[model samples]
Structure formats: structure tokens, C-alpha cells
Target chain A: MTTWMRLMSNDGRIVFGRVENSYLHEYESLHAPVPTGAVLSLRTLTPVAPCAPGKVVALWNNFHALAAKLEKPVPEHPLFLLKPAESVIGSQQPIRRPAHYAGKIVFEGELGIVIGKRCSNASLDEAEAAIFGYTIVNDVTAAGLLNENPHFPQWCRAKGFDTFCCIGPAIVSGFDWRSARVVTKLDGVERQNYPLDDMVFTPAQQVSLISRDMTLEPGDVIACGTSLGVGSIGDGATVEVSIDGIGALVNTLAVSSGEAEAAAAVEGAA
Target chain B: MTTWMRLMSNDGRIVFGRVENSYLHEYESLHAPVPTGAVLSLRTLTPVAPCAPGKVVALWNNFHALAAKLEKPVPEHPLFLLKPAESVIGSQQPIRRPAHYAGKIVFEGELGIVIGKRCSNASLDEAEAAIFGYTIVNDVTAAGLLNENPHFPQWCRAKGFDTFCCIGPAIVSGFDWRSARVVTKLDGVERQNYPLDDMVFTPAQQVSLISRDMTLEPGDVIACGTSLGVGSIGDGATVEVSIDGIGALVNTLAVSSGEAEAAAAVEGAA
Candidate 1:
């Protein structure tokens, strides 16, 4: 089933369902449930790419397993990483793997926190107030590059390929973390599953730690690290990364020429 | 004299001098020659910290004499370096030189660009439109940090100290660069001066070259590298870096208070 979001009016007077299109709610229309119509019919279908984060400051590997794979102990401090801003995609969108990435592409399912408030050096107690909500992230990894040469410099060129990261659905404002779960699938085969509580580091600590170095700006994204169930998607494969409390984001791998053409044409014309 | 900004309003008229009182801009009455007032007149100046960029991409040895000092050929493309956002400071700010920074600190004066748009692989022709305006930047350098120690990471721990980079009194939207000059002074003695055209890499090329691999976001910053004639400010000295068409940024070097207690209190109170 395709998943969408609902939110209460700021005054908490009414519930609005089948809100804005895509999942990240920027503009939404309040509507009652329709007996049988696509979520598009809910409104004019003002769809959007997922939360267009101002910047995606990711952690290299906040997960213990990822640490073990890299032959390191849990970090004394959280590592800083970056994925380009253009990487986010919403539900039903394809994961458009770039041909340059070819065999190196892999998927990492992660729980991402969406910052609602500007926060810096936020304490564990102040963390909740700073978090506007949480969303699911497919922290797609380019293992082929790592497999080719595990080094720091290659990551930007590797992980920053146009569609390497896809985040989706509206943020669930108050997700219960204790038993939250994440699952990744390729063509309906479940490849990974783990309870959120299983993480060596907690979300509270993640916020508290990251705030130490950089002031977390509003709309700055923080992607929780992924589990080990990562693999390359064969050409033309359909992939889905889902979180239990929220929703699933399904995407296909393919080349994207039209957008580049559009940008080129726009530039040329301008 | 305190510097103030003048920006075009939505109606296409010039609006000038809004005191940034803690994030809220309180509109002021005058435009010409910045007004003078006691620090107490404004409730609290919005800590206009130097706009710490997500990245500090610098060009290496772009200056002629500096190129000779390093015994390296001036690069065909701008050689970029990264500075953590922690290093930036705002108007009237003080830069603390920790004892840990073993070498003498020198000042590099350059034209600073405050990005107002996000562009990837942007052409040189599109550089100006991507800028909100231009400001003065003191690209403070730590000779001890990386000078002879080639293994040490450039700028990160050295130039990326708290308050190392300072920008502004105002962001001048339209400033001529063709016949401009930049100068750096320590106390009453002029240390460095060079015509704007002396630089090996032009600002337009700097934007276009760096945008090839990475994205430049709105509010991101770039400090055009300083020219030759850098001299010693040594210990316990005050330095002023300025451009002919723009204003000057003066700062004194001292030690910092760790700020951990302040951060902790701010966190607890956030």
C-alpha cells in the first residue's frame, strides 16, 4: 500500500488527511477520505521531492556494525559526512542510480531526524525540542568505490552521485523510538530488519554530539547510520526501504537524462 | 565607525541600516555614514558571527610572492581548502590565538563572496547572479599550523579556530573590483597591499572551478585569496584587513575560554 501523511492544524482543532503530495508536507489541502481515488485526487496534487534539506550533513558511520566493518570501535565522537542537497527523493520516486556509479551502488536504510528548530550544542534534554520530526532515509552507499579503494577522498565523488540518497514521506513528529524498526527490500525480498533500540548510539546522543561542532540549522538533516543489509541493485531493479512506524519509499534504478537536459537548456537559454 | 548594509527592497527601493539585534532586524532611520551608539543602545547586537560556511574552499599560493615562498607553481585551477564553520566571526569580533597554535599567525586580506544561490557545475558567466553581495573577509592564517609541516591538515585545526575568519560591517551589494586594491595592516604599519587584478585566479573562475565537483549553497562563503606582501603581526598584535571598495575588519588575537561552560549552559537553557 502507498503511504501518505496527516497532520493536525496548529491550533489542534482538526485532522487533515491525504495532505500534500510526495510525503514532505509544504503545501497541503484538508480533505476527507475518498472511497476510491489516487492520493492525487486529494487535491490538485501539488507534489514535491522529499524535504529539500538546506544541507545533508550525514555521519560517516554511527552504527556499531558499520564501525566493525571498517575495523573501528564505536566513535569517541560522531564522524561528519556530506551528501549533496540534490540527493533527496520522496515515495514512489525511482532511485535513479547514475551510470557512473554502475556496480558500486548499494542501499542503506536509515532513520533520519528532521530538525524543526535551530539548535547548536543541544543537550540530550534539549534534543526533543530541536527535532521537528523524523523521517526514513535510504542512505544508499556506493560500495563499488569503497571496494575499489577505501579512502576518504573518493567518498564525495562516489556517495554524491545524483540519486545516491533518498528520503521520504512526511516526518512522523512523535515516533516512539524504543522498538522502531527498519526494513530494506529488493523486488519484495526482505534483505534487512532491526529494531531501532538495537543501535549502539541513541538519537538523543546523535543530536547532542553533532551540535558540538556545527550549529544544526533549521532544515539541516541528520541521517542515522544504516544496518549491514546493503547490496547492489542489478540493472533495472526496483528497491524499497521502509521504516515500521512511518511508511515505505519505493524507487526504481534508471538513468536520468531529461532533468539534465532541462538544466542544460535552461542554462543555455539564460 | 560601525558598518551597515543597504539592500534593495521588494519594491525596488534601497533600504538601509537595520540593527541586527539578536536575529531580529530593527529598521533604522539613516543610510549614509553608519550611526554611532554605545553598545548598550542596542539591546544586544545579533552576534553576527562570521558567516561560517559549510566549506572554506581556498586557493593555494595564488599570490606571486607567496607562491615563491612555498616553492610551488601557481595552480591552473584554484586549489581549495576547507575551514570548519567554527572559525568564523562577525563584526567587531576578536580572534583568539591559542598557545596550541605553535606558529605565528598572519593575515590575508581578500574580497569575500556571500553566496545567495545554489549552483552545480555553474558556468563562469553565471557567477555574479549567484551572489547576494560582497563583503570584506580577513582570511586569518596560522603559519605554524601547516607552514613547514606539510602533513598537518591545512586550515582545519589552524585557521578553523573560533573567530579566525571575520567578515562584514555590511554586505555591499554592488562593488567594483576592476581597479580595487586590498591592504593588510598591523597596528600603524602597512603589511601588504596589492591591486585586485594581481591574483592568479579570478573570483569568477574560482566559483566556476569549484562548482565543478561540489555544490555552492545560498549563504555559503568564499574568501578570495590574499595577495603578496604578508608580514609579521607576531604575538599580541591587532591587524586590520580591508579592500578599497569595501570596509575593513580589525581584530586582535587572544585566547578563548573553551566556551564549554557557556555551551553547556546554553544547551541546558535551549
Candidate 2:
């Protein structure tokens, strides 16, 4: 299995790299990965969110175990949601809670499929070929906001907040996901431990089906829906999303102060 | 009113321009506009989507008329969804029907708010200040897919296909949106004609509330949702989404052949 990552070098330049042992061999782009021979110690570089995805497509209720637990009927097609690219944050980044939202922040550990090529209306074979690698995703959601309004369910707003999507550490290609498992650790306690095979739709099926609905561009992530053990994370708590072959993605939750202050802080830090 | 547009110049480059009568005076950028003396006939330039938005934050049931018609409660906050940037197509582009979806395609005409600044948890005043201009959005959806799965509502997939979002012709600033109306035409017959004042959440309120959930970046669009006349478009049907101040966005629907063929064709064409 090959591991890939995008990291900020000691010189402060963001570059793609193929991780081997404790060294990072730099590459120009993820699409056509070829090492540039600019090697660095993994400790010397800061890991950023690996993929600059055009969009992060997340599934809902695509897990057989979750459906059974919720007592809901299995869906024929993959029901999904789009989390804005702005919601994505790398491992070690703080998951800033929206200042206006005073709700339960839930951590959902998911296996993410990274699309390697532009795929639309693709067959299962083509879809399988399009899979670049796999990564771990913490699909964070404001639980209170989901059903606050009786008229309409606020799925997007409840989950599309900034820093709501925590992904990375590395993308692992050629990993056997069938026997793999997703484990979510909240504040050092194992909260979720589910088999990847519990998914109602397999990775190939998801990629093919979703590609038919929309164009899956290079680097776009399709988060295979989470199973059980989905629970809330308190403010200042640590959440870790882990898939064995693909390393763990860890983030801390922090409630924002307010409008001007948080906005000013985000901009200032940028 | 100042009309802004992104048009394909004679040199095949997409550039921003200020529209005045039949002429387009080129601008350096939309945020801080400066005329660049590169004037061309509006007829000579091909109008593309007005903005390259990071995300299209679209509302659902935000119109009072629609809520009343459906006997649904008026939402206190704007219930929204994110349409990927890939779905966006410029005026006159064809809306490609997904190969796997043999469903009804519907046209939703709505007023689109184009944001001018990066805003997070913004106040009404700050939201109002961030409003760059107004445009028309054709929030297209695969109507049949919306409720095919009983367990989950397919909002994102139903509306996120490539070329599902059609917007542009122009973005008009300093216009009276309160008095304006959205008019949708399918095959030259007007189907939807609803007043803009029927919105449950005003543009300012939507911006402010939505910004609290996620940052609204410059050029990002907020589709205010549709009212009474939302219906389906057949294969090869022409649909037009229009607003008085923000011109019209016209598109044609075409059914895809199949998976391998369509995927190969898309890749070849690209």
C-alpha cells in the first residue's frame, strides 16, 4: 500500500508527497504523482488537508448496521449531502464551532474515497478505476440544528459549518477496505468501532451511483456513511477518526466567541 | 443599476465586464471594480455564468407563498442546501440529464444573492454590506429522485447533477428586489410568476443567518428558493429562468445515452 499526503515543508511551501518510512518524497500534483526528489523528514513538515477537493460529497443512512439500529428501511440509492469545501480541515486543526450555534456537536467517523479522475455516468469498473485512495473523515454536525425547525430538516446547515469536515493524516492506495474497520475515539475513549463491510452500498457501487448523479472530479471525497456510535463531542474535546491502513485524523473542538471576533480571528490567522 | 457579467471575449478568455446598453466595459475585478477601457459590443461577447462561486447556498421553503400553498409552517431561519460548483452552468448551456436517471427534470426560478465579501457570523448590517448584486438562478432538480428513497430525502443528489444549476446573463446591483418577481418559462410559456416579497427570510436575514453557520465568500450565491410554479422539463425541452433586473438564464435539457458511452464521451470532450 502506498501512502500520499500534502504537507507544508519546513520552507512553508505546500507540496504533495509520497510518504515512505519517515521520509516524504515531494511530488507536483496528486493527479499525476511523480516524486520530485525533494525529500524531507516527516517530522519537519506540517500536514495540511491532503486534497483540495472541489466538493466533499457525504452519504446519509448508507450503513446497514445503522439502518437496522435506527429501525429505518434500507435505501435503494445512496442518499447524500454536499459539505462545502470550506468545511474541510486537516488533522491537528481546531474544529471551530459556529458562534451562533449552541448545540451538540457530533463526531461521525467515516471512510472517505478520494476520486482520482473526473468521473460522470461511469460504470462500476470505471468507478473502481477512478478511486485514488482512502482516508478517514470526521463528519461533524450540530445535532440540535438538524431538527430545530419543525417544517424543514436543516441537514446542510447543521453539518456544513466551517471546520465541520475533519480529514487526513494520509490517503492510502491499494488498501483492502473490506476487512478494514472505522474507529472513532472521543477524548481518548473508544466511542465507535464498526466494520467497513457493514455499508449498504459498497465503495464501487457508491462511486458509480454518485458519479451518475454528478461529476466526481479529481480529489473530490465521497465519505462512506458512518455506522453506529455517533455521539456528541463537548467543547474543547479531542476527536479522532481512524481507519487502519489510512492513518488517524485528530482534531480539537473549540466554540467560537462571536461574529466580529471569530471572523477577524479567522481572517487574521489566514 | 450597475450590471456585472462574466463573458467570453473574442480572444477566448473569460473576463469580468460592466454592462451599459449594448457595450461591455471590462473591469479589473468585481470586489474592487476598475474599468479597463477594453470595451466590446455586448452582442459580440458570449455571456457566461456571472460569477465563479465557491458554493451555491440554496434555500428551501423560504417563500411564504410556497409554504402557504403546501400548508407548511413558515421557517424562522433559512433552511438551505449546498449545490456543488460543478453543477453551475452559464446561461444558454445545456442541462445534461444523468445517464442513470430516467426522471423528471424541474426548473425552479429564484432570485440569487451574490456575496461580495468574506463573512462569518455576520450581523444584518454586515450581511447587507456584503451583498454585491443580484442574479437569477435556475435551481434544476431531478424531481422523481427527491422522494424515491423513503428513509432519506435526496435533496443534494436530486439537484446536484452536472449542469443542474443554471445562472447568469447578468448580476444587477442597486436594484429594488423587494418589488421584483421571478418568472420561469418552459418552451416559451410562462409557468412561474411569483413576487420576491413572498420570501420568508429576506436577503439580509438569509445572509446573516447562513453566515453564522458557515462563511459566505465573495462571489458565493444564495438562491432564495422558488414559489408557485415549479414543474418538470422533458428531454430536449427549453427552460428559461428570469428576473426583471437580473436578466434571463436559458438552458436546454438533453438525456444521456448510458454509462460507459456517456463517461467516455465526457472524457473525450473534456
Top model by lDDT, which number?
2
Per-residue lDDT over B194-251 for candidate 1, one digit per residue giving the tens place of the 0 to 100 score: 7877777777777776665466776567787777777655555778877765667777
lDDT scores of the candidates, listed in order: 0.62, 0.89
* Candidate 1 docking classification: incorrect
Model 1: residues with Cα > 4 Å off, grouped in runs = A1-52, A82-87, A94-106, A140-165, A186-200, A229-238, A258-270, B1-89, B93-110, B115-118, B128-133, B139-165, B170-201, B212-220, B224-239, B251-270
Score candidate 2 by DockQ: 0.72
User: Model 2: which docking level applies?
Assistant: medium
Cα lDDT tens digits, model 2, B65-106, are 899999999888888888988899999988988777776789
Predicted candidate 2 versus true structure: per-residue lDDT over A1-270, tens digit per residue: 999999887778898889999998888788887778788888988999989887899989988889999999878888898999889999999999787677789999999999999998789999999999999899999999988987667788888998999889899989899999999999999999999998999999999999888888999999898999999999889999888889899999975566547679899999
| Model 1 iRMS | 6.3
The weakest ten consecutive residues by lDDT in model 1 chain B span B38-47
Instruction: Output the number of the DockQ-best candidate.
Output: 2
